[model samples]
Target chain A: MLDTILSFFKKKESSKDVAKERLKLVLIHDRSNVSPQFLEMVKGEIIKVIQNYMEIDEESLDIQLTKTNSEDGERMVPALVANIPIKGMKNAGR
Target chain B: MGEVIVITSGKGGVGKTTTTANLGTGLAVQGKKVVLIDTDIGLRNLDVVMGLENRIVYDLVDVIEGTCRLKQALIKDKRYEGLHLLPAPQTRDKNAVTPEQMLKLCDELKEEFDYILIDCPAGIEQGFKNAIAGADKAFVITTPEVSAVRDADRIIGLLEAHEIRKPRLIVNRVRADMVKRGDMMSIEDIIDILAIDLIGVVPDDENIIISTNRGEPAVIDGKSMAGQAYRNITNRLMGQDVPIMDLNVSEGLLSKMKKLLGFKTA
Candidate 1:
């Protein structure tokens, strides 16, 4: 009964899904010719600019190279998606 | 004027040569005059795959170097009166022919044949450039694997960069059983990633190996499923509107019996 319950709670992901996800991630970097260091630099710059206006949780900051529908929705294009947690905004006087 | 179509894959061993041989023969079977050129110099395989290796007297390098006339280098296939092959030089490398020479040669071939299918060397190198330089379009071939698909994407990008716009995709060696079990990538998954128009999807059939072993294309064998797939592709290439073959339809009683008996069904 315990094993059945445990199995029920575990999500089964198809290997093809895993392959698709991995291909999408790798192709994003390949198409843009962007390295991990380049992404790191971009993340640092973005954080610096955002930090000037608000306090952010650097530890929780997540940046990824991904794909999204183009403006016309005709095709998929490479996109840089970032999720940064905001602690608080800076004082207006400062 | 004949259309020069280059069959290419970014990675090796994805059946680029096989696809070329099959499609070339398929076109010839349709009564269109076709000539296949092997651009993979020093590693020529199209001739062997077509079962015409022993008949090669002159090669692409010989024609380009003016050592032999263009007509003298082309080996006509006795099986198909409309088909011929220009084998690559076994001793030379890809550097033997330049893009200009290839372009000129393609122009010369355009007057005689209805289709010129260039079996491209794998990878984005001088051989690839030479192969595509004279072509009007391209067909990027890949198997249903991550590495092949990734390399295919790279090849597509390179083809577009070289002004070969909107190259069609041929996803080869697909295993329908694995796809049904979610263990293999489907045609939809590959098309979703590549985002190119699909010309055809060839199922993984053991007949391809058997046919290659005999130095004949799977397309020549009417009983082979892969051969039927190539026939469909050939029709599509000729502006015919044949629907893609339904690979799942074969999973009937025979296959079920094979599965029950623990036998591998092609």
Candidate 2:
């Protein structure tokens, strides 16, 4: 019910919003030179490797490329961070 | 010594050459010796824009290749005596002149001229590289659009990598009506994302088109809004403090109501 009310008040996306969103997505790929297919392949391999060790929640997996400052805060660096939920260990409860 | 400033934009048709012609003319009109260099090579248009296409006996490649002396190659502007143009060769491509050659040419010109403005070609290629080789400063121009601003950001990053610590920004062809209607991005929105110091903002004026067609820079026209903006930018370039021109549309009751409803108005 609250979601519907919030959605009703939400402003419509204008042409400027669409353009800004498109630029945001394209610039990330352009700067990193990474493709969606490559990211999918990497995700599949990572999930396969993790599943061999323990049960995992694949649906909850998230991966993203973001910009972060270097150690000395001198330059911007592209970082790939991931989060995956673990269901259970393969062998024992421990 | 003169300062070599490169007018560059990664995207095409964003008014790099137009800005170069105006700023060069503006400086010359201010009693400064200025030379405009068209580094676009095969796709040269500055000659036509400056209305000196008929007087081109020698081009940039000729001066660099020793085919003609620099003085013989420069085409003098009829309107402004202090303004000259070194046009690009229409036959050869970007590879005809190297970065080293450009640096040497700029070094020789610096001894005589007060300003050396290089009009860079679009895209981050060899032409762009050679254009900036001799520039002590860079002015990155962009329209207040998503694609143009994105390209401008990329160019800024590339300029930083090339050790150009400070690059100014010029937002051109801005629309006041659209901004008042909450349809177009405002200057503040653009500056927030680009994170560069704003040098100038030119309103969308139709006189610019007429002046371009006439091969006369609009900066000399006192009635043109864009011309006024260029004059302010030129003053800023000369270390003078000139306030940016106001581009705000008249605030009617409807606009005031729209603003009260959380609508963003430029």
Give the proportion of true interface contacts each model preserves, from 0 to 1: 0.61, 0.36
Docking class of 1: acceptable
Off by over 4 Å in 2: A6-14, A28-94, B249-266
With a 3 Å backbone cut-off (N, CA, C), the pairs that clash in candidate 2 are none
- TM-score, cand. 2 vs. native: 0.79
- The best candidate in terms of lDDT: 1
Q: Which stretches of candidate 1 lie over 4 Å from their true place?
A: A1-11, A34-94, B249-266
Error of 2 at B138 (Å): 0.6
lDDT of each: 0.88, 0.85
Supply candidate 1's per-residue lDDT for B105.
96
Provide backbone clash counts, one per model. Answer: 0, 0
TM-score per model over all chains: 0.79, 0.79
Question: Which tens-of-lDDT digit does each residue in A13-90 have in candidate 1?
Answer: 788887887798778778766235778888999999998899999999999888798675645767889999999999
